[model samples]
Target: MASGAEARDRLAQTAMYDRVESALNLVNERKSGLTVPNKWAFEARVGGSVSGAQLAITWSRRNEPEATLYLNNDVEPELAAKTLLDRTYGLIAASFADRIIGRDGARDVSASMLRRVANRLNELYTGRFDEIIHGQSLPLVSIDHLERAGPNPFLYHARTGEVLGDFTGLVRQALDRLIQRNRLRIEDVDVGLLASLFRELFSNTHLHARTDLEGALYRRSARGIVFALRPVDIPHDSFAAGLPVLKEYIESMEREAARPRVEFLEVSVFDSGPGLAARTLRSVVPADLPIEREYELVQKCFLKTYTSVSNPAHGWGLPRVMHALKSSGGFMRLRTGRLSLCKWFPPGMKDPRVTADDLQFMDIGGGSPKRHARVEGAVFTILIPVGLGN
Candidate 1:
């Protein structure tokens, strides 16, 4: 492809994702019936085995040589899912492999088996997630979800993009499965509360995070949120070390139970955008301010009064999230800029004044005076104690 001085064409020219043109748009545009512009086209073919049942993807670029990148066959579902998942996230970073065109079983499986498949991919790409404070994707999509596929009480409520629906839809699907799986173990959950928690997080991303659309920078890109929810053993060495509250909670849980069985939900919500403060303060912050003061000001985002979005209805998102988690005794680690803020909302302590006070601050990657190695965008981890008091 050639770059022509950033011409803003009416149609954003990209490629076919599900592998070719004329395939079901992965990113459905809903009721208006307008054709969603796919940066890449994705199409899957049905064979003797079945169309929706077996999908293989061959990502192609216009004017460039074409190759069958991957195809999904029922015989090897995990491999098929792995192939597509690898391609999607990989291409996301692997130089413009966009567009998905399949409406077959591959779509169902990939979306359905998000946790099982994503966890597997995370292991393949990022090694075992159990050892880290941040698990890449959660609600753990895996091949198991596909193998034992059923109506697990999880449903796609809404979507944000043609590829993955909206951020809320993505979060709902993951949590639904997590809730479903936990039930088998006879553990009850507050489904409504969980849904609210995810919605608020999605609102943050929708409002604050700038999205990446095949290397194109836009005020808001419809790249649906990437998230996950997986069960984790409490008191992991790395986690306890970083989060002060984790150690205390573990000790309390153990003291109560003679034989403790502590399970924690590792929730991952990541957005590829500038730091919260930078994106929010793009216009608010003056160009020539000293870096430290600038950093301090950005930290004020959790407060309702310090909102960046002009909409009146939007300011309450983060504050509401904190209240929800606090009511449920949940904890979260928020990473942005050079600050890694961890704060657990205890069961009974209610802080009235908006959020910041609820978090403990740290510099994870490296810097001084509010600085270090910074994340390219924003990463948030919500830790919910499953079956603890519910």
Candidate 2:
């Protein structure tokens, strides 16, 4: 009910997590110029988001040990023709002429600060992962950390994956590495389908975002995205807690591996576009719609008719992803805006892609979608058996 800016004084009096909660609500509001003040320093604390691009933008503005971005709109758009970044730049140019004037103003702020302030707001958004994460000092994957890691632990840059020229390059590298390291053969039916599945997800995250402020997707984006797949071993009791289908899938996988512990790769991809709520709000809600509608529309993304585009190929991306996971007995959790969905496939549920009749089979969790700490963009976490290649 209270706005992000309004929560400021209230936040000052509360404890740490309470302040974190307030910050999350501000970012979710989808308005630019949101500020969360405190005795904060630069750090990587997860959970944050924007209006339309749920995965990316949400992570960018995620309330961390540092401050949330305001006056920057590359990730979350608040208007037409210009992002909050462009508009904020214009306002700053007029109000604080000495500090910055239009594009040239970026030079005044540290690249790190500018990134949080205006992620991918400029032409040169791609660079080294070390600087993107820990600045120029520490190696992206610390050699010391590697020594302590288990045999299956993947060494990667958490703040940003391998720095690429663009999000497209990131997608290629992530998928390629997964296949190569796993020794997946092209002839395997699941291999090609797996590639297709991630390809569609990676490409769609880049494509689907349409900010009321900007017309083009790639043209306005400068910073790169990150995707990582790491190994995880689920405990038997926890497996039981998952959807009944997931428990069986894990059981079968362990039986095949013939090991006491089963390893699964946790795949994650993040993008900084306005969240689904903000994008749909542009078309669906003329007046104040229920905040819960954000969650409902996201679930509807699995249906055939719910698409943001007129193209014949637009709506099938997620369904295909689910189908591939089902083929491989995978499980997933998706978080964006006010929605979070978790689905487990036993390979027996009615096909979602072919028929809308089985929509109820989907498993989605519920909570306060507007809690200040949640992300503004989209973040996907999927668990698939590591031995998928064999």
List, in order, the clash count of every candidate structure.
52, 32
lDDT of 1 by residue, 79-120 (tens): 544443442232232122122223241232223444544454
Q: What TM-score would each prediction reach against the true structure? A: 0.52, 0.51
Give the distance in Å from residue 47's predicted Cα in candidate 1 to where it truly belongs: 38
Overlapping backbone residue pairs in candidate 2 total 32
Q: With candidate 2 superimposed using the best TM-score fit, by how many Å does residue 164's alpha carbon deviate from the native?
A: 14
lDDT of all predictions, in order shown?
0.39, 0.39
lDDT of 1 at 99: 24
lDDT of 2 by residue, 1-390 (tens): 553323221122122323444445555554322322221111111111111223223323442323223322223222411332222212111121112212222233434333433332221133333223221111111111112221111222334542222333433444454445444432332345545655555555644432332443422221112233333344363433323444555565554554454445444444445555555554423225554666566667766566665668677767777666776666666656544555655433355344453343333322234322355446554565544434
